[model samples]
Target: MQATKKATINIALVGNPNSGKSSLFNALTGLNQKVSNFPGVTVDKKTGAASISPTLQANIIDLPGTYSLYPKSADEFVTYDVLVNPSGDEQPDMVLIIADASNLKRNLLFCSQIMDLKIPVIIGLTMMDIARKKGVEIDEAGLERELGVPIVTINPRKNKGVSELKKMIDLVAKEKQSVAPRDFIDSAALAPEVVRDIRQYVQVKSDYAALHVAVNHGELPFLNGGQKLAITNLLQANQFNKTKVQAEEIMQRYGRIKHIMKNTVVEADPLQKQLQTEKLDNILLHRFWGYVILLSIMFVMFQSIFWLASFPMDWIEAGFGALSGWLTNILPANQLTDILVNGVIAGLGGIAVFVPQIMILFAFITVLEDTGYMARISFLTDRLMRQVGLNGKSVMPLISGVACAVPAIMATRNIENRKERLITILITPLMSCSARLPIYTVMIALVIPNKLIFGFFNLQGLVMMGLYLLGFVMALLIAALLKLFISIKEKSYFIMELPVYRAPRWANVGTTMVQKAKIFITDAGKVIMIISIILWFLASFGPKDRMEKVTAHYEQLKTAHPEQSEALDMELQSEKLSNSYAGVLGHAIEPVIRPLGYDWKIGIAVITSFAAREVFVGTMATLYSVGESPEDNDATLREKMRNATWRDGSPVYTLASGVSLMLFYAFAMQCMSTLAIVKRETKSWKLPAIQFAYMTVLAYISAFIAFELLK
Candidate 1:
């Protein structure tokens, strides 16, 4: 027998930036959340299922943060579209508007706008503690009575008042409550004739909806061509001033907000004290000290990523190696055994070892974001970004690119200007991401000496920082150059609200770190595992005659000189690899990469890594037969790579080769995932093609120059 089913309720979480909306979402959804794109847009749609009661399940949609209904960026547009379009998938049964109690006047403006949309609204008032600390007190019942909406004071970070908020949402949704009786503005007065004319053709939800149609009918996707033309004709005929009307509407709403605050909120005394945020900003945002602190923070982040992750990485490597060895001993030796140990185990280990670094990096990023310094970074870098044909908003995506380009590129949706957004998307992948870190660490360990400079600085860490800086420099240079060619005349502005600095939310930070690391391992592990098996096959077998000849030659050598069996066995393996299909393909590209100080094996890695940058390590481990011994597997791979040589008996991974490889990866568009995302973002293959072509050329030239100079 089927169990009784519960009706699902959709609740939309809407708020302004830094309104504690995200914290509330995390608190409600916990670990049941999933992130995906909205139906036709790149804006992230975070949805999760939460149980409001034993028999009631709620599907929560956390919309992008927007200050007002008037959309500016892509994310805001997503929020606006979902709210206004009743037939859409994310059309919420109830709306929860998260507002900062400390900033009631400004928060109320948005709350007023949402109420005018005529949806079932519940105000989730957050940051009440901060308000109390500032000596600002709010009368929640008085405010609710005046607005005609339910108001719940919540501290989502501490799970306070969350149960009450859920109950209110359930009541509102089940009761099918009508829109609040209060109106924020006289929308009919703003554009009387235009609103009247538009409502005749379309089913308008409220007077404000009609006003929005009059102003933005041309851009609204739901409107038919005929309806849009009708609206356009009406606006033209009425000579409706959209700008003047919007300005008047905002002024009227703010006037009402001031009145509401006067009735329900008691403000802190002016002479009480400076805010904690203001006090912190005085030193943190100081012209000289801000830059110094920001730089120091970055330096420490990179250093810690390397230093703190070393022990965990070593442990993971050793554990994996021992497991592989144990498996090899227990299982009978065959092609299947070889594939299992050398291909799957080696591939998994290569990527798993980097989990520590990934976690550390994401943890640092999360802490920075939670503490509110991330916004300050954008504020500080805005002036410099504008000089490079970009705006301050571009800095976040660029900084985020250091983690991964896919999400960083997705982050560009917030950039309003098309040219600025395009340029930001194009150049973002140049920032050295964590995928490149595996390559950097492996190569640096091979070539760069691990030494302390000035007794306090890590020489390896400094080099890592230099590589990161190089990526940023190249990104800026490329943006400036692209700006010269792609000319679009549009005004750009950077208006950001800097939230007060708070102590890092350790739980949120830990969640972010674990989630990001899990994503990296699962995503990269899939690609690496598949490619490693294919590579193992191609490196293990060759043409029947050639395989036999190579085997016979080694057998003869071992028979003649029994004491040199180990050396002969190594020769046979090398010969078999050389004649295998993978070896043949590598040889085909070897000549092309020879001048860049790469051997045939590196050529293969370069080709396979088109799937993902991290696959290079797995490919190398498979080709080198790193699974032969289970113990000390991490060092085994490195030792094998160190001993690799050209036909001329010269070491392959010299300073020249290692540096060249790093430069190549730094500039190359080697990630197919990145290219696919670029295509999705631009909605054209032409841009990704251009991106791939230019990045390939840049990588080759940079690699060549680096190799030639060092060699």
Candidate 2:
């Protein structure tokens, strides 16, 4: 007989924030996962594949973490929509509730509510070790009988109990995704009229699901215009108090969960001594010490990025220079060869050279997050943030801005206050995103000496840290200023659940490092290469008459000094580039940027890098390579920039000019991607317009002041 075809099952992993949902998903899916957005929203949807048994294959969707079915943020809304009204395509056949065994009550409250929805659910209890350390224990079978669903204790990090969980999932799916035998709490008893009315008109799976639709029918995407109108009229006729009904439902669910916990769980006395988490919190959360430690950690992170990445960076830089030289020799001398060697290769090499530094930075970030110290960072910075009209919640997004502002701005969706969210979005771009890493690295190397501070700290690393701090400090100041102008009185509170710190997952850290480096290379690489080619075209050719004159002058000079052929050739190429279209465009903006100590070449870079900040380095590489002297053919980008001079033969990049340029990039709203995200989040171009204007103005002023003072 032929083997049977595998049955496909879709499982939705749901839980409150920090309840081990992601850990379980990672364990189940391993490398068989992909990330995307939920339909019509920016909230991330993580879906993966897993094999449950010989004949069972599963599609696992890791839903956004949320507290309850009642939705507040877009993240919660997506999860709620998926669970209550799963369409044909999104067949969440079984909902796996990832409940923290230690925090059973709260997790159970959320679980029970989902159970009441009459969907198939299996509880994957996690953090058992922590719960045991805290002297908390539960009778698994008893709890399972009480909730009318299978329960499996797991520690996904160790690959424990995952097979059992899969077996349970397969059993549930085989039973036709059996709904709970009884509701966790009767929905009709709380609001008989509303629930009955909804059930009569709305086609739903159960009374509880009908209640959910009735309460939030207006927001449900599946409801048609006629259905919504009908439900709205029924709600009005019944005078259904939505908030009142929701509160009652929550109260009843919790009351039953409390009883179930009392029957099945055993806990040590409250006075038995504080848990380990509490013990650590006392030190890590200390007011003065906490700030000191936070800064120290940040200092170490920045310093390590430089210390660890320097060797690899040097190797990459040397390799690219050698490759460019080799390709130039092998390829025929033509526009195509010139473009390939001097334009595309140079641009790619510029960005690729920084991958080591990028990976190092992301690795550090990933460790902080994996170990749960990232949450404490918010707690430590909350007071300081609130002084600028933000709270601990805003701190996450701003700090996240260090990685990239696009997701950081998207992160502001959790900030409840309108004014605070707007301020966060407006200032997030100033947080010195990793895209600015290339610019900062090159500028600091050019201007700041490579030395050690106090024989312990790297001076270059200290300056990089200072640049980040400068961006953060400026964000706070700007936020405070905006707070004064945009007056809307709204109360905001920061409620964060700081999970117990655990050892860093090295595998996850490595995965994050690789992923971040890949995104940087792929996303930023395409832009840099295109701009480089265009720039090469602009810098390679000029108006017919102007180009002929430059070539003629150079040829005459070469003829006069036959022995200085190579030197004259270099000078000729430089002269031709100055007369090229790119040079003309740069000169147009030269006067405006002159006060900031920038010349036409630097002006061109600043203009092009507005598409993406990392492109600044790529632009430099292409420009300098195209204008290279025959004698300086193998010289690196830094050497080329160091040798650059003005018409008067004075060096172009001095302390004043390099610092000015750095400051300009540091403050500028130079990323179109960030602006687009701001518009999407704010739902208006007006705010993005204002954001662009203010940041550009700030960049100019800061650059101007630094140049004059340093000069």
The 10 consecutive residues of candidate 2 with the worst lDDT sum are 627-636
* Tens-digit per-residue lDDT, 558-596, candidate 2: 889899998888788888888899988988989998898
Off by over 4 Å in 1: 1-5, 555-565, 626-635
C-alpha TM-scores of all predictions? 0.96, 0.96
| Local distance difference test, each candidate | 0.88, 0.88
Q: Which residue pairs come into collision in candidate 2?
A: none
Residue by residue across 494-513, what tens digits does model 1's lDDT show?
A: 99989888999897788888
Clashes of each: 1, 0
* Residue-level error in angstroms, candidate 1, position 252: 1.1
Give the candidate number with the greatest TM-score.
Answer: 2
**How many residue pairs clash in model 1?**
1
